[model samples]
Target: MIGVGKMKQYTNVLDKPLTKGKQEVSLSAFAFLFSELVQYNQTQVDNIGELERRLEDAGYAVGARVLELLCHRDKGNRRETRLLGILSFVHSTVWKVLFGKVADSLEKGTEHEDEYMISEKELLVNRFISIPKDMGTFNCGAFVAGIVRGVLDGAGFPAVVTAHFVPVEGQQRPRTTILIKFAEEVLHREARLG
Candidate 1:
C-alpha cells in the first residue's frame, strides 16, 4: 500500500503541472489509452449498452474524485448554493479543469429555474469516434454526462445529467448538450437562502 506521504507527493506532482491556466497535452496519448480501456471493458460487458454504461460509470467515479481534488485545490471553497451560480461554476471551472476549455454555451431552463444546460461544441472523446453501421446506437457522450452528474452530486447539487446530440449549423462535429436537472429541494433551499 502507498503511504500518505507518497500519495501526497504524487498528488503534488500532478497538481503542480496543471495549476497553470492551461497546458497542452497529446490527444493521441489519451485517445490510445482510452481506446484500450474501452476494449478491455468490452471484454467484460455482455452487450454494447452494458459497455457504454460501464464507461459512464467509470467516468462518474472520475468525476467524483476530480470534484474533490478541484475543490481542495481551490482552498476548499464552499459549494455553490444557487442553481445558476453552480451551473456557471461548472461551466467555467469544472469544464476547464476537465477539458481545458469552457463550455460553448450555458442556458437556463425556461420551464424551471433550477434546470440548466451546458453545451459543448466538440466533446473530446467524440471527436474521433465514428460509429460503425453495427454500432449505430453507441455514443460516448454518456460518459461526459456521468462525469457532470458525479461532479454535481459530489458537490451537493444532486442533479440529473443527460447527454444529447444537437447538430448545429456549420459545425463538423456533433455538438453535445448536457442537461443538468437540479432537485427541487435544492432550489427551495436556495430560494430560502436568498
Candidate 2:
C-alpha cells in the first residue's frame, strides 16, 4: 500500500490457513530453485567472494524470518538466552526445520574461547551444485553459514560464520563445517549473564 498507492486493494491470497498435514516441499523443486539462485548470483559477480557474499546476503533475510518463526513456533515465543541453549536450538530445531533432520554434529572450539561449530554431512545447499575450477575454493554452504550468522545476530549473539569443506573418512560426500566465532562482547555478556 505504501508504494502502490493508486492501485486498487487486492484480497490477500495468503490468508488461507495451512491445513495440510505435512508442510514439506519436494527436494527436487528446492534443488532447482537453489540452482537457479546460484546461477543468478554467479552472473552478477566477477569474483568468488562477491558471489558467495551475495548468496549469503540472500540467505540472511530468510534466516531472519526463520528465526522469528521458529522461536514463535517451537519456543512458545520465547528466545533462548544462554550460549549452549541457543546453540542446541540451532543445531537441532533450526536444522530440522531447514533440512527435515538435525545437523550431524555440534561442537565447541577447544582452542578458542568463544567459538562453535555445526557440521552437516552432504549439506542440502550443495547437493546439486558443483563448484567450477575457476571459482577456486568456492562453496555454496556459505549461504547456510550466513543463515546461521543471521539467526545468531538477531538473537543478540553477534558472530562470524564461515563454511569449509572437510573430507570425512569412510564418507563419500564432503562435510560442511560452519564455524561460528562469537564477538568478544557477546562472550562477555554470555559469561556475565550465564
Candidate 3:
C-alpha cells in the first residue's frame, strides 16, 4: 500500500499529465497588454535601462518561484551538479516549465568555456514588439534573460544572463539569444569534477 505522500505524488502526476497540449492565446491581447505595461513603466522609470531592469527583476522573481515548483515536481528526489547537466536541465526542463516548449538551441561558447547561449527565433513576449524610432532602446526580451538567471541561480549555477537580438539568414523575426556567463568558481568546480 502506498503512503499518503506517495499517493499524493502519484495523483499529482496522473492528474496533470506531462503531455498537456498547448493552448492558443490571442496575440493582440498580449500585445496590447504588454504595450500598456511598457507605457506605465515609462513614467516611473528614469531611463530605458531602468525599465528593462524592472522587467528583468520581475522575471527573476517568477523564475525563482517556477524553479522551486519544477524541482519539487520533477527532481524532488535528486539535485543537479554538473554544468552540461544543468544546461540540459535548463534547455529542456526549465524551458518547458516556463514557455511550454524547449528552447530552439543551446550552445557553449567556443572562445570562452564559461559561457553558454540559448537562442530562440520567436520569443513569446517579443512577438509583437515593434520599437519606434523614439523608443529604439527598448527590448522587452530582458525579462526572458532575467528568468534564465533565476533558473540558473536556483539550480546552483550562479551566472550572468543577458538577452540580445541577433539576425540570422532567412529568418524574418530577430533571433533572441541569451548569453549566460558562469562565474570563475563554477568553472573551477566543473574542472575538479571532470
Candidate 4:
C-alpha cells in the first residue's frame, strides 16, 4: 500500500502547465467510463435518487476544478462578479469547453424571480444513457447540474441545480433543461450590488 507521505510527494497535475493545442478525448472512451460509473453507483444504491446523488457528488469536485481552469483559460483567471456575467460564462465558455459547442439557450424563469435555465439539445454526458421506465423521472443530466452547482458554489453564489428532460418536437436528441435556483442570500446580494 502507498504511504500517505509517498502519496503527498506526487506533483499536483492541475498545477502543471497545459500544452497549447487541441487535446480531445474519444467519445467512446468517455461513454464507456461513464457507463461503468453509473453501473458502479447503481450497485451501491437501492433507489434512483441515491444513485443520482452519488453521481452528482462525484461530479461536484470535477466542476469546482473545471471552473477554476475555465476562468484561467477564458478570463485571465478573473472571476465574474455579476450574476448575468457568470451565467453567460457558463453558457458559453463552460459549455464550449465541456461539449465543444455552446448551450442552445439561456432563459430566466418567468414565474420565479431567481431562477435561470440552460437548455441543451443533447448534453454529451447523456448521449448514451437510457433510463428505464421504472426509473421514473431519473435524468443522467443531474450530474451536469451538480457540476453547475459546484461551479456556482465555488464562485460564492450558492444555488440548487436540477436537470429535467424536455423533448423538442423537431430535435433528434431530447432537450435537457438545467434549472438553477439561486439562494435568497445570493439574490439579495445581487440586488444590492446591481
Error of 3 at 65 (Å): 0.8
lDDT of each: 0.78, 0.85, 0.80, 0.85
* Per-residue lDDT over 1-194 for candidate 2, one digit per residue giving the tens place of the 0 to 100 score: 13345444548846543222355777888999999998899899998899889988888887888888888777778998888888998999888888889999999989998889999888988987777777777889989998998899899888888898888999876788999999999888878885
Worst 10-residue stretch by lDDT in candidate 2? 13-22
> lDDT per residue, candidate 1, 54-74, as tens digits?
877888998898787777776
What TM-score goes with each of the models?
A: 0.80, 0.88, 0.80, 0.89
lDDT of 4 by residue, 1-194 (tens): 22434333328876656433454567998999989988898899998888888888887887898898877776787999889999998898887887888899999999999999999888898888888888988988888998898889889899989999988897665689999999999999999997
TM-score, prediction 3: 0.80
Off by over 4 Å in 1: 1-23, 75-77, 111-114
lDDT of 1 at 1: 24
lDDT of 2 at 132: 75
- Which tens-of-lDDT digit does each residue in 23-81 have in candidate 3? 34456776788678777878889888898888888778878877777777788646578
Top-scoring candidate (TM-score): 4
RMSD (Cα, Å) of model 3: 6.7
Q: Is candidate 1 or candidate 4 better by TM-score?
A: 4
